[model samples]
Target: MVSTNPYNDFLKECQMALQNSIATLHLSIPAISFSLDAPPSPEFGELTSTISFEIGKKIKQQPRSLAKQIVSSIDVKDFPLMSAAKFAGTGYINFYANFAELSKITIDSTLALNDAYGHVQTEKPKNVIVEHTSANPISPINIGKARNPILGDALARILAARGHAVFRHFYIDDVGRQTAVVAYGYKKLGRPSLKEKPDHEIGLIYTLTSCIIEIIRLKLALEKQRNVSTEIKQKLQMQLEDWSSIAAELKGKHPRLFTELLEKISEDKDTENLINKLNQAYEAGEEEAKGLVREVCQLSLDGIKETLTNAEIFFDSWDWESEFTWNSDVTKTLKALKKTGYAFQEGPVLEFDADKVAEDYKLKHMLGIKDDHEIPSLTLTRADGTTLYTTRDIPYSLWKFRKADKVINVVGMEQKLPQQQLKLALWALGYANHAKNLTHFAHNLVTLPGYKMSSRRGRYITFDEVMKEAVKRAREEVEKRSPQLSKEEKERISRIVGIGALKYALIEVDPTKRVVFTWDRVINFERNSAPYIQYSYARSRSILRRVKETPKKFDYSLLTKPLEHDIIWELARYPEVFIISAENFKPNTIADHANLLADKFNSFYTAFPVIKAKPEALSEARLGLVKAVSIVLRNSLSLLGIIAPEKM
Candidate 1:
């Protein structure tokens, strides 16, 4: 079970040949570590090294002349992986791969590796914990929050494929003000039997609780300020009127449920105080508060789980945020931070001195913040003794470090400051190594074309609805193009295409850029999409099916076309591409490579004949090439958690 990367083999040979050439020519240079990378274009050769450009200045000669001199000293016969070495364009040393040997070995290795084609093992595999998709359990997951799980899932898959022991974690943020509000409304409604989707039902309660309480409070204030200024009276009246409109809208949608909650909430003497009690009790681990909140949280979680499972996303562990507080881990971490003299009290609030810690450790530059910029102190606990989410995360982070060597938190970019402060907290608590190993895998936002998402307004689209729309649109596309397929097959293919389309839409773009989720781009069959790549893979499969056994007298050297060479080089580079994707925490790199390879394969298939070529040996070689493309495409897609369907 030897894993072979033909691209690396060629790269190494090129590097060795360059090193030997430098030695053979009696050049006096410093000891150098040799490496080669892909040139800007395929015509430049399979790989390029700029050593001559580096040393030409040192040795006082023109770069092109130095490169030409070095090329003549190397004998290609010694390094069979490389066919030729030459000076290309003003100083660059380029190496041409022997595709005749590369194609044979690349295709043969691909066929042998099969499912494990692109996994290149590292010398030091780590226990990596990826915590992601920690969406609040007060409601169903929305489209705005969908990107986290998809990117997180793809990252875990890539890391695991690359031979790391990867664990996926979902942090259930159950102990929070939002959950307390929803639980309060649910309790007042007698915790009625949920008829609608559990999360949607809970969400209605949350919205109702929020609006009704606001309206009630505003009215009470207006009543008390009867003799106040006209401006103050008008301000209170306007807020009351706004909540009234929102309540009316909710009442129109679910009259019975809204009426029930509104009646019970209006009956309560101090509803806001009750919610505060619930929040504090839950954070304190009171049994009554725990039962009520956990019940509502579990119901919401069940609905969320269904949505994620639809997208084929799952987690290895569901870590409870409250568990840290209950087990006194948060208290322990606070004590440890206090010993470092960075903890101080401001009135009733306790805060961590993140700025002082950064200055003390000289970490402003390493943490990527300017020395002139002040790192804001973090609030550890509120006046009411309830810890903040980031405070709870401190102990949870400690828990994760106990299990793994590295931890990657896939969170939104908006939490950048909080993440930085958490890292400094680790250093303050004497876990500086863990702080160094922690990564904030921050991603940009996802925006719809003409829509804005606001969770508090209850106007956000759910992930479940978007997934259904995608599947429906895919079915139409599948029916229009592949009418010959049976109904069941069409349904299955539609799901595969739709799901893969959504995943690729979120994943193909660089994480630093916002994803513009548009239908035309997502379901595009022409280019740069999952369906296009998937179809190209299917075309290869169909071609292979049309051919019989490969002729024993095949000549891989017949694949001499530019497009053929491109696909061959691409097939050989899958392992290198895979390793890059895994190490850099960028699954988009794999998506980009797969799309490029598919485009090349499609172009080659259109211009060249595979099954009906004149020579039997050439046709056999072409079929072998098609098979190699299929394997690599499927393997790359798998690393992104995409299914490569064999048919349209």
Candidate 2:
């Protein structure tokens, strides 16, 4: 009836035996905190502990001699799931599990828990907020920017499974200059109805408008430099070349849109000033600016929502950045910092002395800053009195802390400095606890081969486009494998397989590592991909369906092969894996565990004949093992926000 992890349970037994032996020997040593590690290879043993060396050092005895004495004194037969405990190497104590008994415990617990097989609930749960994927509303999310939402959603799933109340938030950045320019383009074009995806249209308009504006700015600078020094003229000429190249590329991509926008933007002498005014007005909540920018942002968000929903990603709340500025949160936060002497005025602009605050509070070590490091002061506002993005984010961070115990900002690695500054700003306002609890879960980028993505030039693949291609590729594979399936069934399977492949590929790699994404890697059925795992699950289910009979009881002793033992060991470690992934905010751990379990299960399938064994008792037990494997695989995939189809 115990729901505790079997692997941890076994470790506890080992630790208790060691503790008792130390007491009987009267060994004088400080309380030891040590860990047990799996041997490098199965030849060593299932679990190995090096506590003997530490204890021997303290007692002034040789490690091997101490290990021998401990082994002779301890009774290996006393352990429930361990068959033998012996000394190896210098002082390592290797413990081998009694696979017969271990298999029974693993299979029974998995079947009993079913969908809740690996998750462990905490006694003290917390309310957590995870903010991610707040991509600008100017364009659809491209593959390069897809990692943020995928990682965030996976983290949220793991936390909820661990019994935390989680809230997923997306901060809509509609008050930025990029959005203001996009809005200007939309308004200049008479706010025409989108003939294609709303975001795609917005992206086209943004690129055309940007290209034209650059050409105009460069021309004016070149005209002014005609009588200047040769050095200055060369610099201006280089700038013009860069803008001209971009203009050429933009024109080639969208000829008609570029020509129309060029004519319109060229005729307007104050286009640059107008965009700047719109940005400032939006921040100040002017009715005209608010109506125009919000309308453009809303249209783009409609397209974004469609793509995310297709990927099965949803948010609990959509927070607007402008709301914080409009609701006086930014104003109040600045005033509080000024009172604490952290805020000061540099000319007409406001700034925060982050380095001084860290020195005064003795927070260098806690903030991960070296003693010789010099932190720069952060600019809070422009000379025109408009607050910066990070300044607004400070108020938003405080708002999140009001409803949650911890806040995780899943931002890109390039924003490390800004994220750190935000935390320090919180500490400056005397919210040290909040600052300490704030985590910047930074992730690297994703790239495709031979292709570079640039939103400014409107040269990027949207998430919707990627999903469509994946599904089309998956459907072809599914049809080739299961030609007899109905059209409806094939479609269903293809959708699950396609989306699963995309999600798994994004998450299977470490977040700190860059992913060179390729369809071959994502859709591979051989190893380490979602399809491989899904197919393994389906094979298990296929076995169950063929048997056509359930065993009232199973014999664990029948499952004693090496491959079987490997599967049982991997299954027993699921709870530990789940707990570690949640604690570290790394969903790749879950992905790794799933792929490993599937590999072991597939090996077991090839090595043994289940449902066709000579002895009925062995066949029934193997069937029970397959059922457990299927349950654990499904549970593991769910943690990564993937579906395990029975007919992939």
Candidate 3:
């Protein structure tokens, strides 16, 4: 059978009817294409169009009169799914669906498509790359940075469903000063074996090492200020006091490790210079520096991989930031920028003239820069010839585009300026097409209630910790609900529900919105939560299993009640929802749709009895409806990186 979109069918009918109306009235049709929006309330109709108002103004006629004319020209009998077309609210034309026909079409299509009910393959597909969750390997993944991977994974899933060749990437930032600091601490401790998870162990060393280094640097500055002005001496004292407070805090958390690192670091007078040297050597491909940094980063990444695997997050490629530097990609990028007249020398450093490029290319609007706004030049290299992060990112962006038509960087909102600068650098280097195709999928931070997390201070909750807690909480709830289930079954159910709840909570909110994540909200089984929808699906399956009867034929006309109509309407619109969500890169739409669909299905379950219906035809139709809802709920959840559990 050929696949079809029921909503798209309705849209085509409306467009064709409007064209016919224009021909019948001998009126010139305006070139403006208007949208058909669903009415605010079901009482108004299923689909409402306000195009008559625009057309009326064009033809010098009143809107109400034009609407009546258009309504008169539409023969509702000619449409298969529409029952009537009428004018309402001054100029809006509302078209009501023929529920019996629509219900039949929806059920038939759903039963035929099964798992492929909502997804559609685009005729024109492009190779797309989604790079996200490139968090620094110094610490474990936390809830604050969890949004990037969740959103990126959902986008990759949706685009692949839409027939795009999607590639998921995690750009390992192992070449920066942060990694060097962690590696420095590890080496100072004689590369001790981790007594705990590698990430947690490495994080403690990083934070403790950072604290001691700051104290040393501040004390040295104070000693040098002994002969300076009193004002300068006072400023240096304030800085030293701040570091003293951080040192105290670190000592309280990890006293043994802090004391050891402090003794080891204090013995060396040039610890800061050593870290800087390690950073530069790593970038310059020094084997010793490369080996040590990679070893530390790999240990942290091993723990990260375990956490991601538990959460069902995986990547197609793990791109290393150091690879680009070592392969001369950064050097080639600098040479290209210099040849484009966009790169200039500022003393010993090189800077990209971002403001000049934005103005020269007239990219103010495209780059979200206002005419009165002043963007500063971006430094490409330091005085000592060390490249900046954004400078390396330019080459990485080009590398990503080499294999894909579009590249989306799922970075945080705080990095919007740098992402914009990366794109601008691409434009200045004469790769305007690559610049245009680059996407900055910026997302806001996640906040836990009453707690502020800081990775630098080793005060954040790791992703593994959150997942473990979610499962533990879910286990309690599962036991309370189904105490008779075997231990193995309960554990399995808890794992699925727990992971589903976390993934759902993360992706259900808009990317631009901040999520105050809490256990109460994540594991909610009542309203607007993953467990609620999963329970609904399980309930549907239970009903079908109990009946043990297959509906070889369904009499769709029997499903005419208001609740049935609601379910049918939503089921028919599932394909359209999938299309809009994928095309717009909005997974929240699918999440919202799943909740609404579950609500309708539950209402129908309460208001009507399928198995006890007096007429066998009605029972079969209701069974068909239940099956369709189950299929749709599962498909919708899958789009959001969630699994619809068979049993809750």
Candidate 4:
């Protein structure tokens, strides 16, 4: 990789040395992974690996002999890549780059790429949908909710930038029991909160209703402990029943009000009647259901607009599930599945041999049911002959197949089972003819250290609150640092720095790991944090701000500092960082690169002066170096969905 990486021509010679060694020893290791490694001390080279040990194992020989055999085969025509090939203990081979060559390449390539620094071609732009930030319809997005969306959205940006066809789907888990709780509270004691406008209003009502449920629970708990009369307890029980019934009815009326309702009632017989009632309401132009659906749709649209506009996250289209179940489409899909024997009518309900059909699905393991388990007696049609959610989704998956070559679902890991089952059921129903193209991009939840964020229990943090706190904190930091800065500049910096810190903190970790929100780490100014990277960028800009002359030519010969070489090497690998981030669906790679670059650059900045130097040529070269670093830092930070403020 370093050999092909334009900046390091010496890498080609190093690669040839390794290759020639393989050839001379009559050993044929196809390729070696060239990497940067840190040894216990400086006695070891800057970069090294134990490739010799791996080769030894393959050839069935002692590691020492193999290391010697490989070392003897190396050819150093110009400068030696490493000081000496040493067989440390059990067959470990270590190599280091010549300082002069490494420095030249690092500086030259960084200056050469400029803003277009990190562009790399992908193997193939496989259609991927990194479904993330799939928050429930509990309330507005929170700090925890921000992690998935920002991570997914940034990954999509990096992948698409690298020539991958990435489709980012912000999954809204609107149909569940969680929504049912909100609907129940709304029906009983809560009024619609119109402050958030359409969608926000629903979130507000859900939040308040959740709080109301807690109060009711507490009251009931206390009443049970008291020495109350039997009649009073009975009356309280009746009221509780009434509340539960109202909640159930409300859930039936508005599916989005509770996400868990769909999971619970997905296979229930009552689903058909519910769907029939919903469709009847749709057909007769029943004002209430239609009004509610429209209102919810509006809320979703409004929220999408707000987040996308304010946060710069955009979606090309809102693919609606109901639209796919249009009269002709649903009828045609059902008929086709039935003809294919994927769907069969049995005892007035439609059933599919899901267990027998799972062999073809890669997500089979994710599906809750096993091969021996009876194909779930899925209710496609109720006793009253009404279509269910599965009926709607089968056609919906089919519709996605028809529209795109691949479908990527950005959803939370909690829904892994349902998503898996849904995919399997789709194939069994014959709707998902191109089922192989589907991908469920699942991510772990972001939880507080001591508590879980539950919308049902009304125990959750709002995104707005997190943003406000971040900005407020950033403002305080800025004022403390520069009391002379105007209020306007402080506000501007606060927004960028605060939001940038939040986004960076979230993206800096693997998506599979649960995010524990910690303000200390998130807002920290030192070590592997957003402010650290931002400060580096700002420091580079600050250097340029004090300079007047723009150097037409950089004296690459003068750039031989160890710190400079390290920074340049990190900068030269920006393209690779982005490639890894996109390929793995992890934006943390970019975040890591930024931190590495900043660390190296900070060392370089402190050791050598860029703006003030004795030698004119060396000063110009160092200034050119800082400019290159700035370009890369900006690019890398932007990839992580973070802002690079010139001054923070």
For every model shown, what is its TM-score relative to the native structure?
A: 0.94, 0.97, 0.97, 0.79
- For 1-648, candidate 3 gives per-residue lDDT tens digits of 234588777777776777777678876575856578899888877888888888888878888888899899899889888888899888988888888888888888888888888898888899999998887888888888888888888898999899999999999999888898999999999999998988878888888887788778888888898787788889879988977887898788778888898888878879989989999999999999999999999999988877788888889999999999999999999999999998999999999989899999999987778987877889999887889999999999999999999998998888989888898998988899999999998888787787657776666777788888889988999999989889998999898888888888888889998888776765566678888899999999888888867675788889989889889999989999999998888988999999999999999888899888868888888999999999999999888788887777
lDDT of 1 at 603: 93
Order the numbered candidates by lDDT, best leading: 1, 3, 2, 4
Candidate 1 residue lDDT tens string, 327-426: 9999999888888999999999999999999999999999999999999999999898888999999999999999999999999998999999999999
Q: Model 4 over residues 1-648: C-alpha lDDT tens digits?
A: 123254334445555666677777787755555443445654565545566666777778887788777776774444443445555667766666565555555556566666556767666766655445545544667666677678767877787778767666544443333444444444333234455544455665565454435335645554775786676666667666755664565455555645443334333334323534654454233566545544554564576457655666776555544344434566666676677565677888776555455755544555545555554544555454545555655666666665566676666777665565567767765545456567676777678899878554445676666766778888889989867878888888888888788778777777788888777656555668888899999999999999886686767667776677666667656766676676666678888888999989888888888767858888888887898889889988888777888887
Tens digits of per-residue lDDT for model 2, 138-245 = 889998898888899999899999999999999998877898899988888888898899988887888788767777877887788778678877887887788788
Which runs of model 3 end up more than 4 angstroms from their true locations? Answer: 227-239, 449-452
lDDT score, residue 216, model 3?
A: 85
In the predicted model 2, the residue pairs found to clash are: none
Runs with alpha carbons beyond 4 Å of true place in candidate 4? 1-13, 29-43, 46-49, 58-61, 78-89, 126-138, 167-193, 196-198, 207-288, 327-353, 360-394, 426-434, 518-526
Cα shift from native, residue 180, model 4 (Å): 8.6
Which has the higher lDDT value, candidate number 2 or candidate number 3? 3
Q: Model 1, which residues run further than 4 Å from truth?
A: 1-3, 31-33, 214-256, 449-452, 548-554
- Quick one: RMSD of model 2? 1.7
What overall lDDT, based on C-alpha atoms, would model 3 receive against the true structure? 0.87
Candidate 1 shows a clash count of 0
Compare candidates 1 and 2 on TM-score and give the better one. 2
